[model samples]
Target: MSIAEQFPYKIELHVHLDGAIRTETIVETAKRRNIHFPWETIEELKTHLVMSAPPYHLGALLEKFHTFMPVVAGDRDAIHQIAYEFCEDCKKHDVFYTEARYSPQLFANKMSDGSKPPYAHTEGDITPREVVNIICNAFEKGSQDFGVKVKSILCCVEHAPEWSNEVLELCKEFKPRGVVAIDIACGDLDPDVPHKELHTRAFQLAAQYGIHRTVHAGESGPAAGVRLALDEMHAERIGHGYKVVDDAELYERCRRENIHFEVCPLSSVKTGSVPDDLDKHPLHRFINDEVNFSINTDDPIVLDNDLTSDYEMVMKMGLDKEHVIATIFHAARSCFAPPEEKKQILAELVKVYGEKYMKM
Candidate 1:
């Protein structure tokens, strides 16, 4: 059978909730709030959010964040809409199970007027408790309505180290409601960003509370960032460790430790974090080294790709069908679910695709 007919694939470990907002949904939400978006068309919206030229400097990042912020803010209805829509999209992509991450604290606030905020607001301005509730409720509803399962991971912004504790505290409270992990996201440019100090505290707290830990590293920075994430931050999984190939030792350490790299192929290429050419992606090196990793579309809406398309990219890069199935199973193994649940999902995947495609 062709890969498309493989029926089902059982995992997606890396997806950003805010980044998955549909372009038209953003436009509609903005219109409802009387907030004027800069773009005239959905295509323009997609470009503004995902396809813009970038070294992804602070200015560009802020601009992109501002564009999507309105869609997620305001009342619980907006949050529910975006979250439910995300699950719908996941079902379409055949993502049986997923771990979706976002900074819930960032989604708080209503538009006072059409004008933008003069400066970024710290976590002090928003109630973390309310943000977590909004996110958890949406995820609960999505599962009930669509039969697609998801686990929410509260993500702390790396640039805002001061808010790390508050974010972790919120994650602790939401753990009973299916919030499974905590992550540190945002760019990794400044060498002295205090990622070590901040993530260390959060990781320790998560460990104490028995929640999983992950962090974004090496996507936009050097290979050393990946090492720091593992060594200093105690990250259980590394999000987009694209530069791991640059450090043989770190790559080996990840393989030995069984640390999963949530590699977002489309996002990496679109954001210029990886080479524009798919063939040049460090994923090839990861495959050769047998490093533990999984494919994801970091921002399906923004990157204009999905899990299926990500898999197709791997195939296009000449990974054979066996490797493709193995890659899918690798992703299933990396998910944040409990061990028993993961085992069940893995079995289901094997039953569906393994036997038929194993020798391909």
Candidate 2:
């Protein structure tokens, strides 16, 4: 076996639960419900889930989700099945820890607008907290069955600050129930977000309640957006902060502040956040400067990736084995677990990876 394959211990800190749903599971769920799919076979269905070769713009990547979400709309059991399978997949990969995130508010009954008619397929009548419970329960069950420590994060969208207040409460209520953090993903600092004020307030309140906070920035947005997410939003970590490397000063600021990056190389390549040139990627700078980072599958199934491929890609890009090990520990330190628990995980990793390679 190759070094990457033989090497054990992995932690994926930036994976999206909704985006990583198994395409087969999706097909089965749709078939069980008698929902029509354009593709009759799973092989054909993958073409829709995975993005095409170049020009992987973030907007186009996000549009792919619309194809699947509607298939299981309003079906709590289907959501549970996906979540359970995510854990099983993690176990197959030998992933020791995960911080999987999903937007519970998206599962709730989407209210209709005054001008437009009600949507035909709605996850109707489901309360936001109910959505949280359904997702959390499945992760908790998966954790017990697969022996993978799972931490769930409640995701808030950039354009729906009005919905964040309920999300804040959900984070607080489910903290002990597997919801460890709250995050904003998708876009960054869009003017269309009517409830920016509400979003600011919700994040502040969540911090007070001891909920961990992260934000998706610097991927498709500029470096300044990452600064805003950190300075104004007080985010502990930045998801896909690829553009931060554009500003040397800001990149230095991240290193100084101990803000870790949940770097997903394949997703970056597929999303066009980084150029196709591996040598030009910011991760090299992050590795050389000793900045903390973690290799992750941002959307494993959606992007046709996994933790092993992420680790393998870094090695293919010439990242030293020692540095690759550092990234793994960096991810472990940022797992949203308490200090004591985090220390325990790090110690176990040291034993597995050998004390010589650890940053400690």
Candidate 3:
């Protein structure tokens, strides 16, 4: 059997909703929304959207979001369609459960007061809160229709800490609707952003109120960012935390705490976060030390990959089937689903992969 077939069940903790929109969906949505862009055909769009080469930095990769985001952003139907389709796509990859994260602000075109502009190109009445509502509604229908469990992590953009408070509130408001956590995504870790305090305060509130927290740190930035996330934000997990290996003390602390790392192998190389040489990847050290980490496809639409692609890359990096099975269990344990849902997921995983693989 193929590697993917051998591991029939899988779980992913880090993927972006905006970054995973179907190319066909983009094409159809753009045409309906009357949005204009460079590429119209799917093949041409792939050439523009897919990052086929390595050594590209995170900022350059993120800029690509603007290219198509305007097409679906703020359109209620488009938002619902994409969220629902995401569940279907997850099922296609044999992913039984996944958490897709995105900044609601980026998908909104106006503020709560019906303001003129937000992140999308055209201004409209859609607000970030409304965006969440739409996605949650669609996720409910999609999960039932597609037979895949999908949840969301609302993001606090690093550059827009002002939005962090509302993001926290949204997490609290939508917890029952599959909104499991709040995360900080996008932008570099710059000290000069005076309003960065907003993110910290919001994260603190999230902790007090029991919201699961994850931060995007130490991917392309320094390991110090990872320390900041833990110290200030109370992050239970780190996103793309490859650089944590740079600090011996912090790495030891993380391993000791069993802090989960959402490791995206192909994305690490594609974003120039790790060396192109697979042998020199930080994941090797993670495996040797048995650190708590899970494999994921960070942005399949942009990276031109899927869960299968990430699994295949790790296998090519010398991981055997047993290691693959272990990571699935790692993800299942680290996921932010509520107690009973998490229990059910764990039971299903053990039933498929066997109890022997759980402790690995």
Candidate 4:
């Protein structure tokens, strides 16, 4: 039977909030905030958001993405709305659960109207704490409204080490509100910055608070990046760990350590972090090695994909159905949610899929 004919199970672990925002919503929010968008139409804006231009470069692509952020700037309500939309999209893809991450520092600013008090060392603005609250609040509401479980993580953009500390503080403050993990995300083209310094600090802080840690490594960097994140940062999971396949020792280490990799197939292809052809992806090799990993849509908006499409790609690539099921469970095991929560979700997924597809 074809892989799709056998049915597939899925769970997502590494998605970004800003990159997941709906393009239509971006336009609407821009209009509401009186920010002018360069695109004449929503379709054009989406094209830019997804980087449809031939021959993509990470730095230049990110620069283009920043052009749309002003609309979301100083807008807590818009952030909440975007969060809701993200959960709704997850549900549409049959993703029972998701752990979305965002950089709180990016949204830590006063309203465009400048009504609220300013944060320290800046003109009147909100604090990173405020941004975390807004994001968590939205997730709470979305979970309740959609019957789709969702949790969030505060991401520390590795480019700025000073700002990373602020994110760590916010993560500590929001621990009670279901913020379960801390992530370091940014372009890996230039490894000169040494993620170890900040990641080690973040991991130490998370360990102090008993929060889980994950890091974006090995996507566009050398295989050593994966080793550093695992050894130095002590990450519980590696996001977009494409380079691990290139280093047998690191791959073996990951297997021995049972480290989870949050693989985003479409994002890898779009960004040229991996071969565009699905058949060429090393995910099959990882699966065969029994490497614990999960499929995810890193930036659903930019990749125009979700958990369903990610699973579809696996099927299209000829992955075994039984292995797909096993991977989903592996993903559940790797979730940063509390053990009890993970158990409950796993049981629920097994019950549903087992009855529909796995039963003899």
237: Cα error in model 4, Å? 0.3
Cα-based lDDT at residue 122, candidate 4: 36
RMSD in Å for model 2? 2.4
The TM-score of predicted model 2 comes to 0.93
lDDT of 3 by residue, 50-91 (tens): 988654989878988878887888888999999999999988
Q: Give the Cα RMSD of candidate 3.
A: 1.4
For each candidate in the order shown, give its overall lDDT on alpha carbons.
Answer: 0.74, 0.80, 0.89, 0.74
Q: Is candidate 1 or candidate 4 better by TM-score?
A: 4
Tell me the TM-score of each prediction against the true structure. Answer: 0.88, 0.93, 0.97, 0.89
lDDT score at residue 207, model 1, on the 0-100 scale? 79
Supply the TM-score for candidate 1. Answer: 0.88
Instruction: Give the Å error, residue 77, model 3.
Output: 1.0
Give one digit per residue, the lDDT tens place, for model 4 in 147-193.
Answer: 78788888877766656666777777788898988888867523467
> What are the per-residue Cα lDDT tens digits for candidate 2 across 140-207?
89989998888888888887666688778889888888788989876655423566677767878877
Model 3: residue 253 alpha-carbon error in angstroms: 0.3
Which residue pairs clash within candidate 2? none
Model 4 weakest 10-residue run by lDDT = 112-121
Error of 4 at 240 (Å): 0.8
What is the TM-score of candidate 3? 0.97
Quote the positional error of residue 258 for candidate 2 in Å. Answer: 1.4
- Screening candidate 4 with a backbone cut-off below 3 angstroms (N, C-alpha, C), the clashing residue pairs are 118-124, 118-125
